[model samples]
Target: MKITKLTKGISLKRPLEGGNEEQLQVVRQVLADVRAQGDAAVRAYTEKWDGFTLQELRVSTEEIEQGAKSLDPQLYADLKEAAHNIRFYHEQQKRSGYRVQLANGSWLGQRITPLDAVGLYVPGGTAAYPSSVLMNVIPALVAGVKRIVLTSPAGRDGQLPTGVLAAAHILGITEIYKIGGAQAIAALAYGTESIVPVDKITGPGNIFVALAKREVFGEVAIDMIAGPSEIAILADDTAFADEVAADLLSQAEHDALACAILVTTSERLAEEVAQEVEKQVAALPREKVARASIAHFGAIYIADTMADAVEAINSLAPEHLEIMTEQAEQVAEQIRHAGAIFVGRYSSEPVGDYFAGTNHVLPTNSTARFASGLNVDDFVKKTSMVYYSEQTWANHAPKIARLARMEGLEGHARAVESRGWRKGE
Candidate 1:
């Protein structure tokens, strides 16, 4: 990681994708086949890929009840606590439509409506993430979505992750399927004999799943086309160098492709954090993956001033941002964009990732400029409206007619004129 002169602006790195044209073509074929054959195609793919024979794609209430009961009592309690916090975090973002009446007597307002159903794709590769199940479903539930369907790949024994089942049970979501990957996305997008189609899809998965969602986006709404997880820390002399290094290493531990960087104005802090990073990287269980990520895309920059540091931070617009600096709040205010901001020394990025209540599912790859973190707003839609009283119409008919006619839209003008106010009758 080089601390070079901050002259050239940060260049965009193409975040890695699921696969090349060959793999995408396969995904397209699978989606097409599933769309054509429905349940049989899905089951066949399940057997061939996941190695589990799923006679019934839908998970039953008995299974969920047994799975939840089988979990260690403490684990169930924790998932419940996390679910409550996640629900509370998203609850604040819920919005409602309102009707407004003008002085003249016409009423108009915007209406907010929740989608009927959403398919949440929970990835089961490597390990199941019940946290993801909580993050994706709670928002839609808080938004009052009527139906929340979930799909995840099963193990060789054809079992859903116990933690995932426990979390869903806590959330009161009974609809889940033993499916995963692009195939599951396909089934949800196109509908099958067992898997019901949904209005929207949201979750994180491997490249194949990401690309599958990307391909199906037009047919069904998608939360985001996510890339690898990333985190950036901006620090000053007041910051704890070791803590910064640890936080960066946390995201790096996620995968070899994950990115973690530090940008600061303090040369001493930068060097110390660099050394701490080396010291900590060796001890991590995921050290190899962290090392590769750090070696490839990770960097530490020593900016000439805090403003320069801020400039670099905004340029990255990382998925998770930590401000561990003197006047951290001031730095936070200067930050123009980020998926989520961890404001002080005590608030590490992982806290939000797991327990701190804010959403860990967020826009990656400088998407913060135009995107937002996952919230209740993601699950709802708003439609705008307006109305005017008869008196109000008569009061402004001439101007309306003049503008309509001026635009060469006589029909629009006549529509107003036919009201009988234009001729003052």
Candidate 2:
């Protein structure tokens, strides 16, 4: 890892991947075919990419039960407990409609309604992510979404991962499909012979899945165009170097594009962490991936002061931030931009990734400056409600009309005036 002095306007912003032309063309073609052929297109694509022929698009209830039963006893118990914790945390985010009446007998408010249906895409290429199932599904359930569908690629043996299926079963999700890639996204956005279309889609996948979501966004709402995973640690002299290196490598092992950064006030701590990272990464099973990430994207910055370090971190606006300074909590409170902040040595990044109640799906590629992690709000829609009494309209008609006319919208002005209120009436 390279060490540099912290400077103004420095950033670790990686460019968001928008698939290449060939990939985009392939995604567009798949979406079009899925829309035209429905289940046939999905089956064809699944067989081609996943190497499994699908006799049925939907997973049977019996299969779900069997898969859940097949999980190891301890793992099943852990999933149930994690599901409970996630549900408890998101339940606090549920919202209700509210209205406030004005003195003029008019009312204005907002109504919160859960989406009718939602699709969750769990990636199944290199690894199975049962934790993602717990993170994405629990919030939608808390938001009161009625119909939730899960889709993932099947293995060569024609079965989804037992852990993924077990996680879904624990959450009471019955509608699942053995489909993946751009075709699955298409089927979710547009109804097929067996699968019903959803109002919104969430979860992460490869570049093709991301491109498919982008193409179908107007047809159905999507969570975000997620980039590679990233973590930034802000540590001081009080922080332990070995522990810091472990936390940084946790994300580096995720992808070759994954970024790991450390900003510290102590140069000694920076050097120690770099050495520890090099020594520890050699032992990981995913050593090749982690080594590539650390070699290309990993770095340590030496800040003259703690304030400068925090400022630099704010500019980076990392997806996951760990503050391991003397006053970790105080330093975290000063942070203005981060998808999620883990304070102190005990709150490691993986805690939030797996067992912690906080949602792990977060903004990436510096988008935390404006975006947020997935939450209950993502599964619900807010509709503004306005009720104007005749007297209230009579009082404000002229002003409303005048404002409309100022924008050079004659039709809008006429529509407001057409409410039948005249001057001096």
Candidate 3:
């Protein structure tokens, strides 16, 4: 990992910023082909990418049930338990519509409702994330989404992951398909013969998936164009080196492009954390990916003061941040950015990733400034609804008419004037 004294007013460009773009154009082409040919195009792309020649795009009910039965009983139990907890958490976020009456008898408020059908694209093949099934489905289920479909690439065995199927059983998710990449996204956006079009799509995937989501924004609502996982730690002299190293490695293990950085005022702590990372990383099973991530993207920036450290962290706006300073709580208050904040050594970034009752899907690539981590709010929609009585119409009709005429909108003025009320003195 690179070690340098943290500099104020200096910005470090992310290495992923200069990544390959030829692949992006290919993904766009795949999306366009799928959009034009529908399922036929998707089937060809699936064979090209996942090496699967599917007889059917949609998975069978028996296959899902058999998948559940194939998994370890204990893991199946755990998946159900996790689903319960996630559903309970999201249920609390379910919003209801309310009517607010004005003094003139006008009523207006927001009506919160769920999307009719949604698709969750889980990363498949090399990486099968059943945890993601729980994370994405629970919120939609709680939001009253009736039909939640799932799509993932089929394995070489010509079947989906058992764990993924078990998660579906726990959540009662019926609709699923053996499809992936940009083509799958296009099929979901513009429905095929077998696959139904969904109101929205959520979950994470590779660069191709992100670009496809960006392209299909108007056709179907997407969650976010998620980037690689990243973690940034701001620690002072009081921080524990071991804990800091573990937190950094947690993110680094996600992929070779994943970034983990440390910004601190204490030179001694920075050196200690670097050494600890080296020792700890060797023990991880994904040591190769972690080491590559640390070597290429990881860094320790030693700031002269705490304020400088805080400023640098804010500018970076990492997906996950940990403050292990003496005033970790105080530092948290100064922080105006970051997808999620972990205070003190015990509240490490990984805690929020699993079993911490917080959604781990976070914004990356300096997007924390405007975007937010995945939450129950992502699954629901709010529509502003209004009702007006005759007295209320009388109360505000003239003002509405004047404003409409001032704007040269006779139709708008007549709509108000057609209320059949006399103009008062």
Candidate 4:
């Protein structure tokens, strides 16, 4: 990792590539082919990308039961506990419709309802993310989404990892499919013979899946276009260097492009953390990946003051921010932009990622400046509703017609005039 002195009014560019047009065009062609040929197109692409020829696209209940039975008893118990915490947290975010009546008997409000069905695209094969199954599915379930379907690339064994299947089974989601990549997204957006189209798609995937989601957004709703995982730790002399190094490597090992940054007011602590990162990274199993990520995107920034550190952090708008200062909570309260904030040394980012009930599906690539992490609200839609009684219509009709006329929309004026109501006084 490179060490640098903080400069005012400077912006840093991300080293990772955003989806290029070539990738977009490939996703476009795949989506077009799937929309045209349905199941046949999906099958061909699945073979091309996943390298698994499928006689059946969907996983059966027997397979799910087998997966459940294959899991270690302790791990299975932990999964249930994680799911419980995740569901409990998201249930608090669930919303109900509300209406407000006016003095003239006009009612206006919003109706909140879950999508009929949703598709969860879990990264599979080498990426074993059973935690993601719990993270994505639990929120949809909490929001009352009835039909939750999951798609993942199968390994050479022609089945999803037993743990992934077990996680789905625990959530009562049986509609698992052995398809992945851009094609799975295409199939989810525009239905095939075997898979019914879903109203929304969620979860994380590779660049192909991200581009595919971008292509099919209008056809069906989708969660944010996820990027590489990242973390930023704001620390002082009070923070333990070893713990900070471990947390940084935890995100760095996620991918070759994942970013890990440390911003601190203590130059002494910055040097210590950098040395600790070097020592700890040497022992990691994914050393190559962590090294690549740290070399390319990681940095240690020395800020002149704590306020400067906070300002720099907000400018970066990192996916995860951990404040390990003496006054961690106070520093956290001052932060205006971050996907998720982890306060103090004890509150590590992985706790939110796996077991601490918060969703790990966060906005990346500085999207935390405006967007948010996934929650129960992502699974539902809000529709604005209005109703007017006869007296209310009579009171407002002429005003509506006059405004429509002012906008030179005669059709709109005529529609209001034809409601058989007296003109407003």
Q: Write the per-residue lDDT of candidate 4 for residues 267-309, one digit (tens) a residue.
A: 8888888899999999999999999999998999889989998
lDDT of 2 by residue, 1-425 (tens): 88888887787645357779999999999999999999999999988988878998888999999999999999999999988888889999888999999867899999999999999999985578999899899999999999999998888888888999999999999999999999999999998999989999999999999999999999999999998899999999999999999999999999998999999999999999989998999999999999989888899999999989999999999999999989788999999999999999999999999887999999988889999999999999999999999889889888999999999998998887787746544
Clash list (residue pairs), candidate 2? none
Task: Provide the overall lDDT of each model, using Cα atoms, as 2-decimal numbers.
Answer: 0.87, 0.92, 0.85, 0.90
| Residue 353 in model 1: lDDT | 81
TM-score of each: 0.94, 0.97, 0.93, 0.97
Report the lDDT of model 4 for residue 411. 98
Candidate 1 structure, TM-score to reference: 0.94
Ten residues in sequence with the least summed lDDT for candidate 3: 12-21
lDDT of 4: 0.90
* Model 3 C-alpha lDDT per residue in residues 361-389, reported as the tens digit of each score: 78888989899877777877899987888
RMSD of 2: 1.7
List candidate 3 segments past 4 Å from native: 12-21, 421-425
Ranking by lDDT: 2, 4, 1, 3
lDDT of 4 at 66: 96
